[model samples]
Target: MKIIDVICSKGRTGFFFDDQRAIKQGAVSDGAAYIGKTATAGFSAVRQAGEAISVMLLLEDGQLAYGDCAAVQYSGAGGRDPLFLADDFIPVIEQYIKPQLIGTEVANFRALAHQIESIEVDGKRLHTAIRYGVTQAALDAVAKASKRLMCEVIADEYGTEVSDREIPIFTQSGDNRYENSDKMIMKGAQVLPHALINNVKTKLGENGEKLAEYVAWLRDRILKLRLSQDYTPVLHIDVYGTIGAAFGNDNYTAMADYLESLAELAKPFRLRIEGPMDVEDREKQMLALKELTRIIDERGIGVELVADEWCNTLEDIKYFADNKAGHMVQIKTPDLGGVNNIAEAVLYCKQKGIGAYQGGTCNETDRSAQVCVQIAMATQPDQILAKPGMGVDEGYMIVYNEMQRILAIRRAKANQ
Candidate 1:
């Protein structure tokens, strides 16, 4: 089967109360949001006005799948929104990509992917982005054509068993200042009066100070819930960094301190840490990350590092890999120039024994998320990150959930 059509959808989606809580208190922003709900909380304040740019691909033999790319301000790049590229870039997908793959065999995903990657934009090239877009579309089409859930496809492809254990997702709440004392009291009284009183603390501001307290609360709550045999839900926290030169020495110190605190609080729950690094401040960010890594190692917790800015190219991955800079490498297909590049990076990481995670794009939709899931499963990265689907527009959660199901099936098949 060949690709029969490619569709690109552009628009914005507003956040929900819970989404806002995650973005503000959880520090959700950029690609980090999709990996899990806790990670998306980092952008609580900024994600409000953001838009989603989605690309969907349809193929012959009746298959439909898609993905999305979202843009947010880069802290180091003078707070400029890197996702701004989507505004001008989506048209390229419509003009160059849609018309070319009308009759290609649906299973020739690689060829369709390659052709999409071949398209160029300005003096720069967008073949990678186009390939990613097309691949996702094909996956969606195939899923639809097969009359199977995405999870089933993933199981067939990966040959692994799906774990019945509920995957953990982080959710954020509380005011920015951590001063929702009254709210906390009301909520806490129902649960634990003594513990609430003991944990009662003053409100901290939006920066790391407030995040520290909020994180502590989340960790404690998770542990308490687990003790009572309420072990299904996973715990998470969101930590946002200031953008541009604003992320200077002070910011790094605050981040370091907050992460250290989180390590201490999260030890009992074995919580995982995933967040977007400020790519604009390369030197300072690296220095801060190095410190954070030490903390994570000491705590024996897994850390997923996402580079919204720094890891935007193949060369960037080389730099990180060569230096052994990060533990788990986060990759965004569009940012890396396409599926081939992302695949190459994953291969490099796998060969190097470096864990890889798939980063999400806000501009993506179900189609884009589907494509990402396909590539993500194919790459077998350690983790898959995508946006939450709670707000006005459905986020990439449906795609992610679908992909998770697919991966589960693949895992089952593999074990068989």
Candidate 2:
């Protein structure tokens, strides 16, 4: 019942994070494709320079299972940030993360999973990025050994029944979203068209105008694309905390005023803004988000606030839910440690009467994307983002096609 080996291998990403449409439309710079995909860490200049990390767990009985790790831009500060980077992840998983689990007993999937999540280096918890990979591999190992689907392992472990149903497909977008949006509707997807505005204010000298332009483009896309549904597609803009940095808590009046201005452009379109701002103090930051949500709620604006930063772990998720910081909170899969944690967070959102979006970085591999789809279907989240790439076509196919496969299998088994 003990793990015999752990292997970590290298891989590459599909595209660097870029707003191609914005670039084509002259909203952002030509260099933004590389610069915009990065976080404040000022690490690498290569925009799409990402690594795919796969963790394989070998049991003593020659049974094996594995999972892939996705590299994310804007992973924030701390060892946990950029936890999937090749130099950071490979050595740690091989030297530190592996040894601890290689000989560990796996009699209980839930308990072993907890130990992996809690395993720490230098007195700090294991970086969440590695936790994501190892935990999924561990779960996969155990689930496959039991001849059950990964979600089935989750259901039996958590005392819930597996709900074999189709989960809504949520995919990310670049500036070339018009073409991507057309393809999304063709495949029956609920699109989350986004605009990256973190670098806009600095490069363009005016953030609002650029954001407005992006919003206007989205409005037109919605109109001409003839979105298959009656409800408008949710327009998301990752402010990367630039907006919050520009307008501080001391300037609450200004903050509300600017947010209202943005809302005006997204009028009648369901608007959700991610990472509006970030602060050094997490509790204080959550409070600010709560207050902002309060303002938006009181005004009855169409904009719904979402928390990405400061909302990584289970505690962070519960804190945001309890305080009502956002109408919806992104339960970022990689940030939260593992898949089961997402299950727990989504349930917490449900209990709190808030929305949950199952999210991950585009740096993820296709295997991880498909695995996430299985987990999302088990939980039935409000929405789930396509992974491992910026282009809507491949990411969309990886997820929805898997969903189709799983549904087909279930139907066949049920009829038999």
Candidate 3:
């Protein structure tokens, strides 16, 4: 099938765009919004409604293949593209991208996606969100044209197998950790409660006491609220570098000691700490995480380190994976630009013996989350994130349902 037309429309993401800089600077939360001046250059407020552009490709067969262009919750931070607003980007897409996409063959997702990835305006490439959504539409179009599931298309193109079983789903608990943790437990999330411990004073605590208490509480809560005794979810917390802030960024010894304590408290539940220390620079962040990971391994600490900050692009992921920066590297989908790159990153990480958490931002769309599920199914990442919103139920539901739908179709095809 050929792309007959390219359509773009403004849409709302499942969550709001948060200024990571402001939040890190101690922005106080007032109700659902944050009360502080915007620190990020493009942010209009400390917190603002997240926006996405739906890229729809009209195919010759009258099938409409679409994907949502979305940025992460903390857009413009950790060396990501600037704030992605629909109004600012729609014109750019129409002027530069739409024409190229128009009449293009959709037979090969990798080829078409590479063409989209290669587009440039005034020396810089298209925004990650645009590339992300456009490539998603491309993949969808290819799948539709072939009359196959998206996961199957990906598997064929990438020389991988579609997971016959379900991939583990990781759910995030944004601020409402306690309430969301309960929901996660009830839903039997393979990975429970990201427990957004971004702030030191309130979430992580000055001396890391607060997070320790929260982990202890989380462990107890799961044991108390779980419907089945067999339900044992991995506890993965994203502290956003507060641990490094509290214990001193370079103090790997102290950080390892604290992580060991958290592992002890998490008792029988595997623990992974993400973004343990964001030194704000890519090289330094890698080294810091590398040293930290080394320390934990040498000491035989049970807690696993997850790299997030400064690990944005495909190149960054490979670099981090090669250096053993962390046990797992969150392949933040949107940051990597195209959906094709998400699959490649996951495959690469697995090849390198690094755990790939096929994670995107909470600030994504349902469509984006669904596409991610297909990619995870084909690539078989260690864990896939329940995304687009912080509310545990909606994100989890979207991810879970998509996985089931794919699995059902795959099984039916096999039986046939």
Candidate 4:
């Protein structure tokens, strides 16, 4: 199939973008909006609606394959790309990217995606959102051209087998940790409640008592509400570095002691703590996490450490994985620039004996979430995030349904 033309359209993401620095610096929440000046460079407000650009490729056969370009909720804070406003970037994509893609013969995905990753204007690579979406469109176009599922295309190109079973889905509960978790339990999410513990005062507590209490509560609630006793979901919480904040950031021993306490509280359920500390610098963050992981291993702490902050790009993930920075690394899909990198990152983590959690942000679109499911199906990460929103049902539905569709189609093909 050949690309006839490229189309860009403004779109809204499933969630809003929040200034991570402002929130960490005590931005008070006023309803859904934050009541403080923006601390991030490109933000007009501490919290604002997330924007996306849908890059659609018009193929010769009248097929429209597209993907949404988006950024994380905490854009520009953790060494990520700047806030992705569609108004500013759509024109850039049209001017620089559209013409190059026009009339290009699409036979394979990896080369086309890498070409997108290599394009630059004014001496800088295209915004991560643009590269992310355009590559997704490329993958979809190749799949459509070859008459196969997106996951099949990925698996074929990457020398991996498509997952015969559904990847475990991890659902996030924004602030409605209690209520939304109930929803997750009812739905039987494999990984229950990302429990966004971002702040020290409100969520994590000054001494980490608040999060401990919440973990205990979650244990009890899951036991009570689960329809099937076999539905023992892993408790994965993204603390956003609150554990490090409560205790000193470099105080690995203290952090490990606290992690042990939480592990004890989460008895029968396995626990994973993500972003225990974000030193804000990649090298420092890796060392801190490595030391913490070493301590946890030496002490035989039942808790697992997941790396998130400062591990943005494919190279960053490899750097962290090479050092064993954390037991698991979150391949933040959008942060990796191209979807091709997401697959490579996952495979690399597995090669390095590191757990790969295929994750993106709540500030994404349904289309992105769907495409991510295809990637996870092909790559078979340890767990794939239920994304595009924090509300349990919508994100979970988008991810779960896509996985089922892929599995069903693959099953039929095998029978045939």
lDDT of 4 at 299: 98
Better TM-score candidate (2, 4): 4
lDDT of 3: 0.94
Ten consecutive residues with minimal summed lDDT in candidate 3? 406-415
Off by over 4 Å in 4: none
Off by over 4 Å in 2: 15-42, 46-48, 59-63, 78-83, 103-107, 202-207, 227-231, 245-250, 261-264
lDDT of 2: 0.71
Error of 2 at 305 (Å): 0.7
User: What tens-digit string does per-residue lDDT give for candidate 3 at 242-319?
Assistant: 999999999888899999999999998999999999899999999999998988999999988999999999999999
Per-model tally of clashing residue pairs: 74, 3, 0, 0
Better of 1 and 3 by lDDT: 3
Candidate 1 minimal-lDDT segment of 10 residues: 191-200
Q: For residue 84, what is the lDDT in candidate 3?
A: 93
lDDT, candidate 1, 1-416, per-residue tens: 55657677765532322232233333433442322243222333333344555676565545456655443223113122233344666777777666776775544334445666666657655534444545555555555766655434444544433334322211223222233222223222111111110011222243445435655775565455443543423233323333112234335444545555655665554433433344435555555555555555666554333333455566666666655555656565556655556656766777777666555444344545555555555556655544333221133345446656765775676799
Model 3 spans > 4 angstroms off: none
Model 2 Cα lDDT, one tens digit per residue, 42-74: 344434466667888888889878887664544
Q: List ranges where model 1 is wrong by over 4 Å.
A: 4-90, 103-105, 127-131, 141-208, 227-238, 242-258, 271-284, 291-309, 332-334, 337-347, 361-363, 389-416
Reference-based TM-score, model 2:
0.86
Please write out the lDDT profile of model 4 over residues 284-370, one tens digit for every residue. Answer: 999999999999999999999999999999999999999999999999999998999999999999999999999999999999999
Clashes of 1: 74
